[model samples]
Target chain A: MSSSSSGNVGIVIVSHSSKIAEGAADMVRQMVGNAVPLAWTGGDTDGGLGTNVAGILEAIEAAWSTAGVAILVDLGGAETNSEMAVEMLAEDRRARVVVCNAPVVEGAVIAATESSGGSSLAAVKRSAEEFYA
Target chain B: MHNVNASRAANAFAPLTASAVLVNAVGLHARPSVKLTQCAKGFAAKIEFALAPDGPWTDAKSPVKVMRVKAPQGATLHFRVAGPDGKAALAAVLALVHDGFGEA
Candidate 1:
C-alpha cells in the first residue's frame, strides 16, 4: 500500500490455500520488512480451496503501485485467475501487472527483496522468474 | 610439486577474498540470506560465496541463490569479490557475517 510513495514495485501472492498465501506473505514481510508493498489472496468465494479472480483483483488494488505489480501463483488455476484479474483492470493498468511463472513462495520472497532495493517492475518480475531458471 | 606450484600461481591472481564464520543460531536462513544479498547489492563489486576454499560459488546479490547456499551456523563463508570497490564490498559482507546478521 505504501509502495506508491516508495516507488517500488508491488507484489501479490496467489494460492489455492489461504494458509499458504498468508504464510508466504509472512515470510516476505519478515525478510523484506515494510519496504515493499505486498498482498495475498487465496481460496474461493466460499472459503474453500480454490482461486478467486475477484479476490485477486482486490489484492492487486490493495498492493498497486505506479511502478507496477508482480503476481506469483502456486498452480495453474491461480495463474489463470490472476490473468483474468489483470484483464479486468483498465488497459493501462493491465500492462503493468504480470503473472510470473515461478515457484510461489520462493518467487515472492525473491521478488520482494528485489523490489525493496528500488528495482523496476520488469526487474522484479525477472528476479522472481529466475527461480525457475 | 607441480600441482602446488599451479595452485600458488592461481592465488597470485586471485580476486579480493574474505572469510567469516556464521555465528548466528540458524545460519543462512531466509532472514540472513536476505540481509546478505541486500548488503551485497549495495556495492558495485561482483561478489560470490562458497562454503569451501574450492567450491560451487553462488551469486551473493541474488537472494534466492544465496538462500540455496544454506550454509549452517559455524560454517565458514568464503567470499570472492571483484570490481573497483571489491575491497569495500568484501569488508561489508564480512562485517555482516561477523555481526551474525544482527541475530546473534
Candidate 2:
C-alpha cells in the first residue's frame, strides 16, 4: 500500500538470459501484485547470453526507493555485474543496495513479498537471504 | 514452548482453532504458501499449523515452515490462533483454505 512512498523497497532481478530475469519478475508480480516495485535486466545489449553493468544499473535506478533495493542475480557474471552496478550508484544510493545471496527465483519472491508487506531494507534483505537457508 | 508467549495474550478469550482439507490438485505449493503466509500476517495472533489432528504445530507465519508440512490433496491442515484477533484470523484463513485457495 505504501509502495509508492520512499520507504518502499524495490527488487532488481539480473540474469544471463533476459527471459529468466523477466520470467522471475513476472512470477513475483503475480504473487505480490503490482504494488511492490520490481525491475529486471539481463542478457547482452546485443541479445546474447551475458550481463552488462549498464542494464543492471538501470534496473537498480528504476527500482530505487527510500527503503532501498535488493539485487538477485542468476549467474556468476551477473553477480559481478550487479555489484559493479551497485557501485555505480551515487554514494547514498549505493549504501541502500545489496546483492542478496540466494536463488534468484525464490529470492525475488521472498523479497517482493516482504517489500509488499512494508518491511524495512534490512528486513527485505534478510527475507531474501533466508531463502537460501 | 507452548507457554513462551502466554503473557502476550490479553486474556483467555478462547483461541480459535479450525481444520480444513486441501482440495486443490497441487495442494500446498508456492502460490498457496504465499497466500497463506500473507493471510497469517494480517493479524496479531500467533498462528500455528499442524498436518494432522495431533501433529506437531509450527508457526504458520513462516513460509518455509508452512511449506514443510507437505500438505497434499486430501491432507488435513489444523490451524490454531491465540491473540485478541484470534477468532477473526482463524476464520479468514479457514475461508481461504475452504475456497481451495481459488486454485481448485
Candidate 3:
C-alpha cells in the first residue's frame, strides 16, 4: 500500500446481493480512486440473496486500517450480519469498526469520499449518515 | 470554457458568491456531483449551492447533498462560499463547473 492511502479510514460495502455490493464499490473507486482502502461482500456462501457474517468479516479485514473501517449495509439482514462480523473481530479491532445506518450505495460513496479526504472514522460515518438525516 | 460571474459581499462576514452554467451533457449527475463535492472539500470554506440565486441551498461539500441538487444541463449553479478560503473555494468551484467537470 502507498503511504498516501495509509491512515485514511477504510470502507466496506455490505449488501444482500453481490452485484449491489460490487457496484457500490465501483462508484467509490471511480470517485476517490485509490486514495482509501475499500472492499465489499454480499450474498450467502450458497451464492444466493443473503449476507454472510464470515464474508463480511473478511471484507472488514481486507479494507482494514489503523484509522478505522466503516461498513455500509443494504438491508436489515446485511446490517445484522455486519454487526455479527464486527463482534467476531478482536476486541481492539472491534472498537474501530462500525456498521453505519445509511443507504448502502450512497453511503458507501460518501463515506469513501470522506475517507479519501483523511477524515476520522467518526466523521466519515457522520457524513454517510447525513443521507438519512 | 464556461463564463463565471464572481462577486464579493459588502459585509466581511458574508459569503462570496459565484454562478456558472452546467455545460456538460449530463449536468450535475452522479459523477459530476462527486467531483464537485470532492473539489469543494479541498478548501476550508463552507460552500453551498442552489439552483436559484437565493435558494434552497445545499452543502457543496456533501456528496449526497450535492448529488441531490440534480442540476440539469444548461442550468445555472449558484454558489455561496464563506470561510477563510472563501475566495479560493469560489474560484475552484467555478473553475470545476466551467471545465464541465472535465466531461464536456
- Chain B TM-score for each model? 0.86, 0.86, 0.87
**lDDT tens digits by residue: candidate 3, A1-133:** 1338779999999999999999999989987678899999989999999999999999998999999999999888999889999988999999999989889998998898888777899999999998989
- After TM-score superposition, the amount by which residue A121's alpha carbon in candidate 1 deviates from its true location, in angstroms, is 2.4
Every candidate's DockQ is 0.50, 0.41, 0.49
Quote the RMSD, in angstroms, for model 2: 2.6
Off by over 4 Å in 1: A1-5, B1-14
Inter-residue clash pairs, candidate 3: none
Worst 10 residues of 1 chain B by lDDT: B1-10
For model 2, how many clashes?
1
Q: Is candidate 2 or candidate 3 better by TM-score?
A: 2
Order by TM-score, highest first: 2, 3, 1
For model 2, the superposed segments whose C-alpha errors exceed 4 Å read A1-7, B1-14
Q: Write the per-residue lDDT of candidate 2 for residues A1-133, one digit (tens) a residue.
A: 3335456688999999999999999999887677677899989999999999999989988888888899998889999999988888899888999999989998898787777767788888887787667
For residue A38, model 1's alpha carbon misses the true position, in angstroms, by 0.4
lDDT of 1 by residue, A1-116 (tens): 24333588999999999999999999998878898889999999999999999999999999999999999999889999999999999999999999998899999999998888
Clashing pairs in 1: none
The interface root-mean-square deviation of each model, in the order shown, is 1.0, 1.6, 1.3
Ranking 1 against 3 by DockQ, winner: 1
Q: How accurate is candidate 1 locally (lDDT)?
A: 0.88
Question: Which whole-number lDDT from 0 to 100 does residue A8 have in model 2?
Answer: 68
